[model samples]
Target: MIDKLSWMAIYPEAALLIMACVIALLDLSTTSPRRTATYVLTLLTLAVIAVLTGFNAAAGKTIYGFGGMVVSDPMGNWLKCFATLALMVTLVYGRPYAADRGMLRGGEMFTMSMLALLGMFVMMSGSNFLVLYLGLELLTLSSYALVALRRDNALASEAAMKYFVLGAMASGFLLYGLSMMYGATGSLDINEVFKAIASRQVNHQVLVFGLVFIVAGLAFKVGAAPFHMWVPDVYQGAPTAITLLIGAAPELAAFAIIIRLLVEGLLPLAIDWQQMLTLLAIASLLVGNLAAIAQTNLKRMLAYSTIAQMGFMLLGLVAGVVNGNTYNAQFAYSAAMFYIVTYVLTTLASFGIILLLAREGFESEEITDLAGLNQRSPLYAGVMAIAMFSLAGVPPLVGFYAKFAVLQALIASGQAMHIALAVFAVVMSLIGAFYYLRVVKVMYFDAPLTATTVAAPPDVRAVLTVNGALILILGILPGSLMTLCAQAIVATLAS
Candidate 1:
């Protein structure tokens, strides 16, 4: 009966895929300009799906589809919500820019966007290596095309090529790692791999090597340092809309990959990956923060900042594994999830502002581009200031609390290095503050780049209203979201 209750739970994910295909078909068949209609319909579809997912969660049923490959746990539910919200914000932000640039291409853009969302769905629900890989590929492929949508822009073309080449190499490493793991355990199922590893006590060095490769592959996807050479370039070169999409989902998906494999499949080999993550985290912090300071381009700066954030998330994973307490691990995981949510909102909001200033054939990449913005639109300047403060982990902002919670988890577990890294993270964040504030300084102090304020499309305005309010709202009352995060981690990693 549980299996047969219509299984409408997965409709949220299916809606995205179905919408993508349908939009593509309609575009090819009819040359009518129903672009706004497509946008409205797409947003509506996602809204309905979000409502359904919420309803399913409230009903308290564990819904799985495709023979246990896609589990409907709280982790899936939460990430799905994050992915959808982020995409919605991007659509609202991008619609005007796309229209102005004459690049919306109506159906094509909508299709790729939804396809990327579907890829995110795969990441959220994937319970096996095969499903995870498939999902990741779908997201990567869609991202590549979206980046190159302009076709004529040299930078966009270059970004797509680099992304494709690097993405292929990462896939190769991941596939090789999966093959090695299969060789060691004679199984591809995560549950079976865990049981086998737990039951046997042998030095399976081959499997360990596979773990290294697998983690390397995942780090590449997350754009973590030492595996992050491609990040700034891609983020800088991709269309701003595509950059927004890439930033939102891939890191969350990478985190899921780590949770499923490192936390479950290789638990007995804890010391190994924990040490690896610590070193990786430190490298990411140093490289990401140090490199970001020199970037003149806003998108590239944010891309490096993303790398820095990934490093912080790994701090939580290392804390969880090394401390050897289930509750501590849960706290660490919950902290990481909270941070991800915080970062996603902040990142989307930041990008949305960038879109506001951006127009066709006039992409605003330089920090100088925003000179004298505060006087032009005090509201935008204020909202952007809060976003910057929050991103820098300043006090009374949600970003600060996210970092604080993780730091507390690390110190409470008595991990000396974790505490040290948090200190370093704070320092790098201080270094990062210089740039985030530069945007603020330009807005507040410098003369206006444009004497007249630009007006945005209504959709963009509506989206900003929610996005701006959310950052402060979260900072003020994070308890509810924090509780939900804690519960989600519990549902995902059953002890």
Candidate 2:
């Protein structure tokens, strides 16, 4: 029977849901074009959720609720905390852009985003296949609505349709795989499935078949190549504000589900899934880097860059098990966690600049649009440069250390194949640097298209400044965050 402990485990989620409904109703009375009342309440709600999750994460205790269908653990809590903050930042950076584009006519953007975040929380906390699938659908459905939020835009309508059809297919793949696992193991619970597989009582062929579809679904969610046909289009076609909304926080949820499903639930099948992840990583790097190099559109370029970055993150997961020994798992997974966190930080700052420049009718979509950005507004340019440099894995930036940590994890595995993958990843990063630096070059060296200084709301300016500074500061002092990630992973593994 459900008890207080079950309710305690999900207090933050409950608060978010309640507040989202309240904000939707509150918007009816808000006459302000910017929906200031709704926006402030939403931010306050997210802040409270972040603080609550942060405290829970720091407590470092695992709590199971809803008959173990959901779990509250350090890793999940920390991820939820970060996701909350990311969403808050996305909303802050996005609001002005949304207001200008008439997308904020109602409070659907704010309410839908909160609901999407609630979905992410569910995904991260889910310990059962059915719960996880429900979370995934909630997130995807919200995303489809968000992408098509601007009902009058043809590009948005097209993007929404594509995302819906493709997203449905991916969901089917994941659900089918989960059903097959249940058929084989006679359980929907992750731990029970793990135990069944470890006991060697399941049909190996059926398990492998399910595993393939599971990996495919996960790859699609993370925007890995061969299943990444939707990323660039959606990113470019969606209103810029909505693009940032979908691109940033959802990644953390994706990583969380991957850990819950593959590492936690199916560790016994490590060899099979590891092989699939390696292939996915390699293809993601190849396609992401090469395609990004040819892109003139900044959003599309970043989309491909995201695919490549996720590939590097996957390398950390690939190194988690060596010869079936899980000794390296904590460090490897922590590296991935750290990498995703830093990537989201950098993405926020980069996109914040794009949103700032996309004033009213002027969409700063092309790389040329950033020409002489330094001359127009050095502050935004500097933020964008830091983001680009970090993304390129340049020194004294978070991205460099993020890449280094993952590479270190790979090399420590002492496997020749892992080492070779590390080397290949470095080569791809070298190729990636050209495109990132090209943005910096355009910002600094090229002539300005117009001499208008970029103006931003005080809130956006403050947040963007801090966001960029954190990228550089974290790069210089990464030990604390690294330790936090390690501790979270250790606690999770112990639990």
Candidate 3:
């Protein structure tokens, strides 16, 4: 049933794949010091994709193509647009840092990142089990190479190996679950599977058995505690630039798949999955925040922070279908989406500051490395301070609102356990604030570790400024983005 519209549905993805190949060839042929040609080409490609995606989203029509294996909808389009923007900013903030560390010796970083982005695009659009799994592999394979790009760093190589082994295991869990699902329902299409399950035409026990594995796989992907062993090590060992690449944008893709699998494909099993998510969220918040309090490395601390933040997102998902009614589905899912989007924005600036502080031979991996950052460069310190405060869910910042939205969704569910969950989340967040504020305190109150002035290229500085400003502006006035999320989710569920 492939048609012209099927191809049209994938225009942005097609353009990116072609451009990535062209850029790879151009990088090999050109003899530029900074690989300026490749950099410009990559950014231009991303900008064009972003524009196309925004246009598609604004059109507000849901199109299913490729025999219903791929979907073009407001939710997918908006996530793709933002993911492309995140990649562009990642490259901009990363270039100087990558160049300083000789990571630009080859163009693999740029090409691989572009490919990983393509994977995200596919994941967002996938409406079939096989398509989703394929997309996940593409992204993880590219990320493995990116993490080990340094080749000479033992720690980097070790992190890559660990990520590879664990990622493969998770993929197997997902695949095995998908097979069981297909056997139970006799379909690979997500919508059809949903129909089968919702109609009570499938064996309930088999479906739930398969769902356990699927949830386990997704839990690993999102780095929930008990499955987050690789996060801290990889964040600490991989180059900061690669860590940012892994952290910032792929989260949108992760959220997309969660919706496609759990909500769209298995809503009939909400009571079952929600129970699992509840346990995962509680464990993640408990382990992530408490363990982070002991870390000295900023990256590792942020790694734990990412886990806790993801837990908060899960809270939204768990509250979506209380008492077998989905009247609140859009609100709950939209809150989770908004939280992920804003978290990525703050993360970009947080890691951008770390990347900026690293000089020719100095890596700012330790928290003490930021001691008295205000004395060295008030502007950079201020940006970092804003990011830290925002992540801590402090007042008048986006993080607080993100948490508040999720907690509100949880409390509104009217389940006693959910109300308890909301209270627990607040307490865990209060504990987590200690580490985030510690970073800020060191920046403003401690003595400088070195007298060297913080410096960054104009482009990096410009991006960081915009990133920080957006965090504050969105915090103060979050209506537009929140509305957008609500619209996107409503449109998705309707389709």
List ranges where model 3 is wrong by over 4 Å. none
Return the lDDT, model 3, position 193: 96
Worst ten-residue run, lDDT, model 3? Answer: 29-38
Instruction: Encode model 3's per-residue lDDT on 1-495: one tens digit a residue.
Output: 568989988888999999999999989986776789889989998999999999999999899889999999999999999999999999999898888888888899999999999999999999999999988999999999999998888988998999999999999999999999999999999999999999997889999999999999999899997888888998898999999999999999999999999998999999999999999999999999999999999999999999999999999999999889998899899999999999999999999999999887888989999999999999999999999999999979999899999998998888999999999999999999999999999999999979999878889999999999999999999999999999999998997
Cα-based TM-score, every candidate: 0.95, 0.99, 0.99
What is the per-residue lDDT of model 1 for residues 190-262, given as tens digits with 9 covering 90 to 100? 7777887777754479878998998888888888889998899999998888888788756677777788778
Sort the predicted structures by lDDT, highest score first: 2, 3, 1
lDDT against true structure, model 3: 0.93
Q: Candidate 3, clashing residue pairs?
A: none
Over 4 Å off, model 2: none
